[model samples]
Target: MTASRSSTRSPSVKVAEVSPSAASCLNVLILPLAIFNWYGGTWIRNELEVVVVVVVVVVVVVVVVVVVVVIIIVVMMIITIIIKNHNYAFIINRVPLYSA
Candidate 1:
């Protein structure tokens, strides 16, 4: 027995309608003047000043936390060394050791 094959066709393009009463498409002559005069330079300066303040606050907080952690670690190490060094000789020798 033999089988049959089928073929498909592509779709066509579409067209849009334009009106005569519409204004010209390139009518943006006053856009730059409007934008520059709208907010001026103070807006950008204020934004940058706020960003710098926020960054400085973040850095200060991180440095303080790091210093606190380092101090805690140093205190713990000093305590450990003192305990090890000042222990009685007999007490240390009395501890048992495991061997294989």
Candidate 2:
């Protein structure tokens, strides 16, 4: 009876010891994965932010260039019209008018 009781108790004690070691092993395996996930997510977010800023800057530069070009073209057209009108008036004054 004594030997049987000891055998049963020994198995239970062994099981109790093995349970803690198994739990520790699981922790060891899972901790690195959790850390990697946190850092990896942050890295990806930083990269996305940089891309957004670059795209916005490029868009702004393009819009400014287009606006400047349009203004220059409009100014040139106005100057051309003024010069032509002045020349026409000078030519009319130089011509002689005869009364019939």
lDDT (CA) for every model shown? Answer: 0.60, 0.69
Model 1 local distance difference test score: 0.60
lDDT of 1 at 59: 89
The global Cα lDDT (0 to 1) of model 2 is 0.69
Q: Total clashing residue pairs per candidate?
A: 0, 0
**Model 1 ranges off by over 4 Å:** 1-45, 88-100
Worst 10 residues of 2 by lDDT: 9-18
Deviation in Å, model 1, residue 62 alpha carbon: 0.0
> On residues 1-100, what C-alpha lDDT tens digit does candidate 2 reach at each position?
9888766754435533458886686556555545766877434255455446556766998999999999999999999999977768777887879755
TM-score of each: 0.44, 0.43
Residue pairs clashing in model 2 are: none
Q: Write the per-residue lDDT of candidate 1 for residues 64-86, one digit (tens) a residue.
A: 99999999999999999998898
- Candidate 1's displacement at residue 57, Å, is 0.3
